[model samples]
Target: MASGAEARDRLAQTAMYDRVESALNLVNERKSGLTVPNKWAFEARVGGSVSGAQLAITWSRRNEPEATLYLNNDVEPELAAKTLLDRTYGLIAASFADRIIGRDGARDVSASMLRRVANRLNELYTGRFDEIIHGQSLPLVSIDHLERAGPNPFLYHARTGEVLGDFTGLVRQALDRLIQRNRLRIEDVDVGLLASLFRELFSNTHLHARTDLEGALYRRSARGIVFALRPVDIPHDSFAAGLPVLKEYIESMEREAARPRVEFLEVSVFDSGPGLAARTLRSVVPADLPIEREYELVQKCFLKTYTSVSNPAHGWGLPRVMHALKSSGGFMRLRTGRLSLCKWFPPGMKDPRVTADDLQFMDIGGGSPKRHARVEGAVFTILIPVGLGN
Candidate 1:
């Protein structure tokens, strides 16, 4: 019979193998394509077999207007978009130089516009072809490790207040457009607070996510922020069925605003590097550590008490984010490691309270939390609902 230590070793090896298999399955799934749950369906195809040395990544949207129209409330489509972008980045990192085809079969103007924005921010074909998109535009900010010469307006440094101010100015412009397009009636949003929230997220990515476990920058990486306005019918039963907190929040907003639908501005920040759990642990996590424990570590990072950085001033970023969201009434989704967590804050709440309980495991397609494949780096998506006109 095997000794206790040998048995434990065998278990650990089995777990490691399982994780590897899961990761491979995820990659295969992405290569095949992704189908969003409920109404939306977007497909991605990577690296055609006939392309001798080069690879091509293509994205197609199905179901016409619905597929291209709504994004923030649903988690699957957001994940699918990120996966497509990540795959493109991975192929570029592998030195595959070719055109990435982004075709919108629906041909909605907004869809085409959003695709252009995505292509620009991701630098999908930077410097190779005239078709390649570049330049800093409102609502999309492209952050890169390589510095550009001659006063690039979009280049942002997280610690510098002036750069942050410029970044927030662009954000406010984007938000203003959203309000005008949606015909929303409300007071000016706390852009300063919103800017602070973004600063913290950018700071975290720059400090922790830019380096490897051994503290080396990645040879090839992609990082940026993309903003979009999604119009959602309030009390969207199909989308909110699995998300109890969001359902309740939406219902409350409908009651307060007395409107059946609302528009939301989604701000998504992505980075390519080691994920949150890996950075916090600062070592190779043992297979024996349960996913629950890993999740706990990730959650702790949001608390004011936790700081992976040695400096005392560094840790308040995430907590401040929580505070801002709590005060403004919004939704946040965090994807990193093997976890997807979500939180929703109801609007016009007298009690501006936030606790760890507000953070809960995301219900994927109306199912309980399952073994999720690890996400490359981290993606934070925040949704701020537009107030309804009386």
Candidate 2:
């Protein structure tokens, strides 16, 4: 053994290196034998590493050893450091157990122990691991419970057990409320029409678009239907292909309205990707329309058939919305290319159908610049006008 001074210096250096080495090893050994309980190995990178005194551990989710007990903290005191590490492993085990055993899924002592670890972490480090250990939403049970009850008409996606009101039921309620609020006659309200519209929109999303994409159909009123579709993937096609049918649809809805008052039917669809292009806009909608109308038309584009992967038979989504507006003496709008348009018509107003020389098509001949066009996702919104009897 060395003298007092020499022993102190050697001891300090060894301990400091040992702590760092342990942290580094922990990082490398993340969850390496987690399934092997007796051989459980966890890695941690202690922050504020020192050569002599004071040890501070700062870790992030990235350096977490196992996929399960993923947590980081600034734990102090060397003895407490080991305890914190153990607590972390316990929390991971608990989370895993809560997922499987508590839910009646799987069973493994090690796995069970892992869950117990999570519980222990919650109990032991309640003050230190509030957000890190347990999230703000401490769910008593997993959402998967709802998923298990298949075909249960009353249950939804495993989380909200069978909605007392299903989508269709919600649509009916919305229609009833709208009718009463707007003083619309029972005969005047078209439940079948609304349902057809809602189902049609959902069908396009489910059958054609990405399977993971989600859609919601809601009846805003007796006269209005709202479709909230997400992750809309736009096809690279000319918008002109769908415009004729869209124009026709709008005209038809207008012709079917009760009074001369304006009614609106809107559909909104979006995606996780970027927005659409300017060149597409120039070729698709009538430029003379106002901002909101332009926005609506651009949004309505993807709802048309040629755009939908499913039934390519009748791509009348856009025209249906457009025609409905025309009948109500309202207008059509198209929003694309970081730009928007609103095209309106007065009562008894004739269709514009302006010549190529007109302001609507002044710059419509050639495609807009390509570099300016980024491959972005698309959002489709369709709004129809309806008339309510006073």
> What's every prediction's RMSD, in angstroms?
12.4, 21.5
Candidate 2: regions farther than 4 A off: 1-172, 190-193, 199-311, 328-377
Q: How many clashes (backbone atoms < 3 Å, residues ≥3 apart in a chain or on different chains) does model 1 have?
A: 0
lDDT of 1 by residue, 136-158 (tens): 11223233433333112443543
For candidate 1, the TM-score is: 0.63
Worst 10 residues of 2 by lDDT: 47-56
lDDT of 1 at 22: 42
Cα deviation of 240, candidate 2, in Å: 28
Instruction: Score candidate 2 by lDDT.
Output: 0.30
